[model samples]
Target: MHRLLFMGTPDFSVPILRMLHEEGYTIVGVVTQPDRPVGRKRVLTPPPVKAEALRLGLPVIQPEKLRGSSELEEIKALAPDLIVTAAFGQILPKALLEVPKLGCINVHASLLPAYRGGAPIHQAVMDGCTETGVTIMYMAEKLDAGDIISQANETILPTDDTGMMFEKLSRTGENLLKETLPSILEGTNERIPQDEELVTFAKNISREQERIDWTRPGMDIHNQVRGLSPWPTAYTTFGDENVKIWKTEAMQTDSEGKPGEIIELTKEHILVKSGDDTAVAITELQPSGKKRMTASVFLNGTGSQWEKGDLFL
Candidate 1:
C-alpha cells in the first residue's frame, strides 16, 4: 500500500476520505484547515475532514496557513508517497508540492481548464450550466492548472442547487480517483496538459453576487436563487428589510407587470415580474433576522403588508 496523505476540509471531501479508509488505503496523515468560528453563536468548530480523520484514527494537522508555516514541516515529516487533496481550501506551497514522490493530485469539482477555482460547483449552477464534472489532476503551484489524470461527467438537473451538485460531484470525483489511483501508483498514468485557452475561473462568491437582480430574466433569477440556495442565499430588499429568497421557480407565462413588481399574490406563492417579460414564483423565503418560512406563511402573516404593485426592490 502506498503511503497517501489525504488533505481536504468539508462535507464534500468526507466521502473521499471514507472511501480511502474503506478500501484500506495507507493514509499516512490527514491535512485540513484549522478550526474556525462558525454560525450565529460564533463557536469554534472543527472542519468536517478533521472530525472524520480523527474517527479513522489518523494523525491530523490543522494549519492556519500551510505555506512557510511549521505545519508544512510537520506534513513533510510524514514522508508521504503521494498527497491527494479534495477541497482542501488552500493552495499548496511549492515546497510541499515537491515533497511527495508520486506527486500531489487533486479531486477537483469541475472539468479541467474550466471553472478552475474555489467555487466551481456553485458557479456552474449559477451560470445555469447544463452539465459539470470532476477531474483528477496533478497539483501544480498554480490553482487547479494541473495535468489531467482522469475525469467523469455529471448532469446538472434544472432544479439542482449548489448543495445537490456538490454532493453529486464529490461522489463522482471519489469514484474517478478510486479508478485512476491504481494507474498512477503503477507509473502508467496519462498526463494530458490543460488547454490554457479553455481556462475559466469560479472564484469565491461575494456579497454583491448574493443580491437578487430583478432586472434579469426569470431563468437567470431562478438559477441565481438556486445556485446560492441553502447557503448565503439570494436576497431582495422589501421596504427596509432584507428577505432571503430560498426557493423560486421560473414561470413560462409572460410578465403582467414591470420588473420586480408584484404581479400576483396567492396563499401559495408570490409572483414577481422579471426583466425577460416572464415571472418567478417565490415559494420560500426568510425575512431579515427571522427564520425561513413558506410563502403562504409570509402572505398571511407579516407579508400581508405588501400588495400587488409593491416592488421587490
Candidate 2:
C-alpha cells in the first residue's frame, strides 16, 4: 500500500476519503481547513473532513495556512509518497508540493478545460449544459490547469438542481479515484495538458448572481432558480419584502405583461411574466424572517398581496 496524505474539507470530499480508507491506502494524515463558526449559536465546528478523520481514528491537521514553515516541516516529516486533495480550499504552494514523493493528485468536479474553477457543478446546471463530468488530475501550481489523469461523464437531467448534481458528481469522482490510483502507482497512467483555448472559468458565486433577473429570458431565470436552491436561494422583492423563490417551472402563455409582473395566480401556482415566456408554478418560497414552505403556506400568512398584477423586483 502507498503512503498518502489526504486533504479535503466539505461534504463533497467525504466519499473519496471514505473510499481511500476502505481501500487500505495507508493514509498517514488528513489536512482540512480550520473549524468555521456556524448557525445561530455561533459555535465553531469542524469541517466535514476533520469530523470524518476523527471518526476513522486517523491523524488530522487543520492549518490556517499551509505555507507556514512549521506546518510544511511537520507534513514533510511524514514522508508520504503522495498527496491527494479534493475541494481543500487553499491553493497549494510549490514548496509543499515538492514534499510528496509522487506529487499531488486532485479530484475536480468538472471535465477540465470546461468549468475549470470554483462552483463547477452549479455553473454547469446554470448554463444548461447537457452533460458534466469529474476529472482526476495531477495537481500543479495553477488553479485546475494541470494535466488530466482521467475523466468520467454523466448526463444532466432537466429537473436536476445544484444539490442533486453535487451528489452525483461527488460519487463519480470517488469511483474514478478508486480506479485510477492503482494504475498511477504502477506508473502506467498518463497526464495530458488541457486545451487552453477551450478553457472557461467558474468564479465563486455571489449574492448578486442569486438575484432573479426578471428582465432576462424565462429559461435563464429558471436556471438561476435551480442553481442557487437550498443555499443563498434565488430571491426577489414583493411589496417591499424579500421573497425567496425555492422552486419554479416553465409555462407557455401569450400574455404581454411587463417582466416581473405577476400575470396570474391560482390555488396551485403563481405565473410570473419574464423576458420571453412565463414562469408558472413557483411551488415553494420563504418570506423574509420566516421558514421556507409551500406557496400555499406563504399565501395564508400574507394573503392576496401576492396575487396577480403585483410586480416582483
Candidate 3:
C-alpha cells in the first residue's frame, strides 16, 4: 500500500478519508486546521476531519498556519508517497507540495477553470447553474489552478441548496478519487491544463452577499435563498429583527405592489413583490433568536403582527 498524507478540514472531506481507510489505503498522517471557536456558547470545536481521524485511530496534526511551521516538518518526516487534500482551507507551500513522491492532488468541488475559489458549490447554485461537478487535479501554487486528473458531472436540481450540493459533490469526489488514484500513481492518467480564457472564480461569500436583495428579479432572489440555505443563510430585516429565509419559490403573478411590499399572506406563505414585477413565496424562515420553522408554524404564532402591505426591509 502506498503511504498517504490526507489534508482536509470539514464534513465534505470526511467521506474521502473514510473511503480511503475502508479500501485499505495506508494513510500515514492527517493534517487539519486548528480547532475553531464555534456557535453562541463559543465552544472550541475540532474540524470534522480531525474528529473522524481520531475515531479511525489515524495520527493527526492541527497547524494554525502551514507555512514555516514545525507541523510541515512533521508532515515531511512522514515521507508520504502521495498527498491528498480536499477543502483543506489553506494553500500548501512549495516545499510541502514537492515532498510527496507521486506529487500532491486536490479534490475540488467544481469543474476546473470555473468556480475555482473557496465557495464553488454555493456560488454555482447562486448563479442558477444547471450542472456542476467534481475535479481531481494536481496541486499547483495558485488557488485551484492545477491540471486536471479526472472529472465527474452532476446535475444541479432547481431545489438543490448549498448543503445538498455539498453532500452530492463530496460523495462524487470520493468515488472519483478512489477510481483515479491507482492510475495516477502508475503514471497512466492524463493531466489536462485548464484554459485561462475560460477561468472564473467563486470568491468567498460575504455578509453583503448573504443579504436578500428584494429589488432583484424573483427568480434571482429564489436562487439566492436556495444557494445559501442552512449556513450563513440569506437574510432580510423584519422591523428591528433579522430573519433568515431558508426556503422560497418564485411566483409568476404580476406584482400589485412595490418591491419588498407584502402582496399576499397566508398561514403557509408570505408572497412579496420583487423589482421584476413578480413575487417570491417564502415558505420557511428563522427569526432572530429563534429556531427555523415552517412558514405556517411561524404565522400561527406571529401572524397577528404581520399584515399585507407590510415590508421586509
Candidate 4:
C-alpha cells in the first residue's frame, strides 16, 4: 500500500478524498485550510474536506501557512509516497513538493494549458466553451502549469451553469484520478507538456467580475449570469439596492432601447435591452435583503416598482 498525503479544502475535494479512502489508499494525513467564519452569526465552520476526513477517521492538519510551518514538518515526517492536491486553495512549497517520492499530482478542473487557475469551471461556461475537462498533472511550481499525466473531456451543455459544471467536473476528476494512479505508481504515465501558446487563465472571480455590465452583448451577459449563479451572482443596481440575476437567456430579437433599460416585463420574464440591439430575459433574481425568487413571483409582489422604461444600472 502506498502512503499518501491528501490536501484539499472545499466540498469539491470531498468526493475525491472519499474515493481514495474507500479504495484503501493509505492516507497518512489530510491537510486542509482552517475553519472559516460563515453566514450571519460568523460561527467558525470546518471545510467540507475536514468534515469528511473526520468521518473517515483520517488524521488531519489545518495549517495557516504551509511554508516554514510546523505542520509542513509534520507532513514531512509522515513520509508519504505521494501527495495529491485538489483545490487546496494554496500553493505548496517546493520543499514539501519534494517530500513525496512519487512526486505531487494535482487534479485540476480545466484541460491543461487552458483555464489554468482557481476558477476554470466557471471560466469555461462564461467563455461559452463547447468542451472542458479534468487534467491530472505533475505539480509544478507555477500555477496549474504542469505536465499532464491524463485527461478526461466533458461536453458543456447549453443550459449548464457553474453549479452544474462543478458537479460534473468533480465526478470526472474522481474517475480520472483513479484511472491514472496505477500508471503513476509504475512510472508508466505519460507526462505531456502543455502548449504554452494555447494557454488561457481563469483567475479568481472578484466582486467586480460579478457585477453585470448591461452595455455588453446579450449572450455575454447571459453567460456571466450563469457562470456566477448560486454564488457571488451577477448583479445590477436597481434603485438603491443590488439585484442579483441568477438566471437569464439571450434574446435574438431587435429590441431598441437604451442599454440597461427594462424593455418588457411579463409574468415569466424581465427583458432588459443591451448593446448590439440584443436583449436578455431574466428568469430568476434576488433583490437586496430578499431571497432568490422567480420573475413571476417577484412581479407579483413588486410589480409597480418594476416597469417598462426603468433603467437598471
Candidate 5:
C-alpha cells in the first residue's frame, strides 16, 4: 500500500478520510486547520476532520499556515507516496509538494475550469447554477488550476442550500475519489488540462455577499437567502432591527409595490414586494439577538404588530 498524506478540514472532508482508512491505505498523517473558538460562548473546538482523524487513530497536524513553517518540514519527513487533500484551507508549499512521489491531488468541490477557489459550493448555489460537481485533479502552484483526473456531477435542486450542497458534493467527492485512486496509483489516470479561456473563480464569501438587496428579483433574493443559509445567513433591516433570513420563497403572483414594501402577511409568510414586481415570502428568520424562528411563530409574537405597507429598509 502506498503511504498517503491526507489533508483536509471541516465535515465535508471527513467521509473521504474515513474511506481512505477503511480501504487499507497507509496514511502517513492527517493535516487539517488548527482548532479555533466557536459559538457565542467562544468554546475552543477542533475541526470535524481533526476529530474524525483522531478517532481513526491517524496522526493529525494543525498548522496555522503552511508556507515557511516547520510543519512543512515535518510533512516532508513523512515521505508520502501521494498527498490527497480536500478543503485543506491552504495552498501547498513548493517543498511539501515535492515530497510526494506520485504527486499531489485535490478533491475540489466544483467541476474543473469553473468555480475554482475557496467557497465553490456556496458560489454555485448563490449564482443559481443548476448543476455542479466534484473534480479530482493534480494540485498546481496556482490556485485550483489543476489537471483533471476524474469528474462527477451532482444536480443542484431548487431547494438545495449551500449546506445541503456541501453534504451532497462531499459524499459525491468521496465516492469519486475512491473510484479514481486505483487508476492514480497504477499511473493509468488520465491527465486533462483545464481550458484557461473558460476559467472562473469562486472566491471566499464576503460580508457584502451576505446582505440582502430587496432591489433584486424575488428569485434572486431567494437564491441569496438559501446560498448563505444554515451559516452566516442573509441579513436585512426591518423596523430598526437587524434580521437574518434563513428561508424565503419567490412568489408567483403579480404583486407590485416599492421594493421591500410588505405586500401581504399570512399566518405562515411575510410576503414583500421585489424590484422585479414579484413578491418573496420570508418564511424563517432570526431577529438580532434572537434564535431562528418560523414566520408563523414570529407573527404571533415579536412581529405581531407588523402590518402590510410597512417597508423593510
Candidate 6:
C-alpha cells in the first residue's frame, strides 16, 4: 500500500478521504486548517475534514502556517510517499512539496486549463456552463497550473444550484482520485500539460457580485441568483432593505415595465421585470435580518405593502 498524507479543510474533501481509507490507503497523517470561531456563541469549530480525520482516529495536524522549517520537519518525519490535497484553504509552500516521494497531487473541481481558481464550481454555474468536471493534477509551485493526471466529466443540470453541483462533483472527484492514485503509484499515468490559452481564472467571489442587478437580462439574474445559492446569495435592495434571492427562474411575460419593478406576486411566484425582455419568477427569498422563506411567506409575515409597479433597487 502507498503511504499518503492528506491535506484538506472542507466537506468537499471528506468523501475522498473516506474513499481512500475504505480502499486501504496508508494515510499516515492529515493536515488541515485550524478551528475557526463560528455561530453566535463564537465557539471554536473544527473544519469538516479535520472533524472527520479525528473521528477516523487519524493523526491530525493543524498548522497555522506551513512555510516554516519546523512544519517541514514535522512533515518529513511522516515520510509519506504522496501528499493529497483538496480545498485545503492554504497555498502550500515549496519546501513541503518535496518531502513526499511522489510529491503532491491536487484534486481540483474543474476540467484543467479552465476555471482554475478558488471558486470554480460557482464560476461555472454563473457563466452558465453546460458541463464541468474534476481534474487530478500534480501539485506545482503555481496555482492549478500543473499537468493533469486524470479527469471525470459531469453534466450541469439546468436546475442545478451550486450546492447540488458541488455534491455531484465531490463524489465524482473521489471516484477519480481512487482510480488515479493506484495508476500513479505504478507509474502507468502520464501528466499531460494543460493548454495555457484555454486557462480561465475564477477569482474568489465578492460581496459586490452577490448584489443582483435587475437591469441585466432575466436569465443572467436567474443564473447569478442560483449560482451563489446557499452562500453570499445574490441580493438586491427594496428601497433601504436588503433581500437575498435564493431561488428564481426566467420566464417570458407580457408585462412591459422598468427593470426591478414587481410585475406580479402570487402564492407560487413573485414576478419581476428585467430590461432584456423577460421576467424572473422569484420563488424563495430572505428578507433583511430574517431567515429564508418563500416570497409569499415573507410578504405575509412582514405585511409590507408592495404593488405591481413597486421597484426593487
Worst 10 residues of 5 by lDDT: 249-258
Error of 1 at 264 (Å): 0.7
| TM-score for candidate 6 | 0.96
TM of each candidate vs. truth:
0.98, 0.96, 0.98, 0.98, 0.98, 0.96
lDDT of 5: 0.93
lDDT of 1 by residue, 241-293 (tens): 89999999888765467789999898899999888866899999999988899
Model 1 weakest 10-residue run by lDDT: 250-259
Q: Give the whole-model CA lDDT for all candidates, comma-separated.
A: 0.92, 0.87, 0.93, 0.92, 0.93, 0.89
Positional deviation of residue 125's Cα in model 4 after best superposition, in angstroms:
0.8
| Model 6 poorest 10 in a row by lDDT | 298-307
For residues 136-195, what per-residue lDDT tens digits would candidate 3 score against the true structure?
Answer: 999989989989999999899998999999999999999999999889889899999999
Q: For model 4, what is the alpha-carbon lDDT of residue 157? A: 92
- The window of 10 residues in a row where model 4 has the poorest summed lDDT is 298-307
Model 6, C-alpha of 301: deviation from truth (Å):
2.3
CA deviation > 4 Å runs, candidate 3: none
Candidate 1: residue pairs that collide: none
Task: Tell me model 3's lDDT, rounded to 2 decimals.
Answer: 0.93
Go through the candidates in order and give the C-alpha RMSD of each one to the true structure: 1.0, 1.4, 1.0, 1.0, 0.9, 1.4
Clashes of 1: 0
- Per-residue alpha-carbon lDDT of model 2 for 113-175, expressed as tens digits? 898888898898889887999999998898999999999998889898888888899999999
As for lDDT, the candidate ahead, 3 or 6, is 3
Candidate 6: clashing pairs of residues: none
